[model samples]
Target: MPKSIVVPEGTSKPIAPFSPGTLADGVVYVSGTLPFDRNNDVVHVGDAAAQTRHVLETIKTVIETAGGSMEDVTMNHIFLTDWANYAAVNSVYAEYFPGDKPARYCILCGLVKPEALIEIATVAHIGRP
Candidate 1:
């Protein structure tokens, strides 16, 4: 049977109907994470770059909780309200994966939260043979 994992409470969330992660077939699927902090409040005030960093940090925590590291992330889906901020987000993203870059797709979309300019989710491979 596939096992589901719930990310710890203190971390950020999806802002609506979703768990942070689920582990199945040795692959961890993380939900899209916004810039929300431990208090469930938006962390980045007026900066998309800050918001991007915040979301990635939350994604990192989710990955770790699933017995995986950032390096284990095989794929990522990045949602952005504005593609113009790609460079802003990419700059911060580059810092996280310096050596091995995961396959990813970035798309521009409307976010349910007003303050969120970006959200990130990932699929990771864990429990290697």
Candidate 2:
């Protein structure tokens, strides 16, 4: 099946050659999102919780633009620049995904942007059983 790109309004232009999200066969594949402003500069500086919230909001926008919701998310790949921010990340994550959380894995690694403490890519199925 053919795929379509999903780019929500107000989303920052990607720094690289990739769409923010792609819709294929009822699934929305969201690109790894960072806490960056429209200018592509990292936000929230040293705060992990704020960064997580920003990333999730960006993901939400892409998913919704692709006709899906956070509830439809099936999996997530979470990346953190420091393990010290794990708990902070989790706290903000829980706020977005209240119950029946999606399957996810978190890793500690350096991000493309040093000031970006967290990045999350998501996969969600829409209108599929």
Candidate 3:
């Protein structure tokens, strides 16, 4: 089967040259998603917890739209600019995927938007067309 791109309708628009997620061979490879709102504005600019929640929700929307769920996520790639916000980010993340968590790797990195405190990308096992 040919690979297909999944662009979530209600999530923030991509500010770069990448799709929200790419579906190929029953897997959805999500790009690094920034904490932007529907208007493409940075959300909760300085608040890591709030920004973390927003980004996760946005990722959820994209995964669900492509016929998957948080439970279907095989891996999550979490990116952050500062290590100081680690605890806060993890707190919010725990609330979202409390059980059967996916494999993940968290790393400190520089993001495109300076105001973005957290960015999350994922790989989900989508089982539908």
Tens-digit per-residue lDDT, 1-129, candidate 1: 768775865854445778899888888889878888776777776688999888887788887887788888889899998878899999999988888899999999987677789988889898732
lDDT of 3 by residue, 55-106 (tens): 8888898888788888889899999999999999999999988998889999
Cα miss at 29, model 3 (Å)?
Answer: 1.0
Question: Which is the leading candidate under TM-score?
Answer: 2
lDDT of 3 at 56: 89
What are the models' TM-scores?
A: 0.89, 0.97, 0.92
Per-model RMSD to reference: 1.9, 1.3, 1.4
Q: Which clashing pairs does model 3 show? A: none
What tens-digit string does per-residue lDDT give for candidate 2 at 38-110? 9999999999999999999999999999988999999999999899999999999999999999999999898
Q: In model 1, what lDDT does residue 111 have?
A: 78
Cα lDDT over the full model 1: 0.83
**Which candidate comes out best when scored by lDDT?**
2
Candidate order by lDDT, decreasing, is 2, 3, 1
Q: Native-vs-model 2 lDDT?
A: 0.93
Question: C-alpha displacement of 5 in model 3, angstroms?
Answer: 1.1
Colliding pairs, model 1: none
- Candidate 2 regions off by >4 Å? none
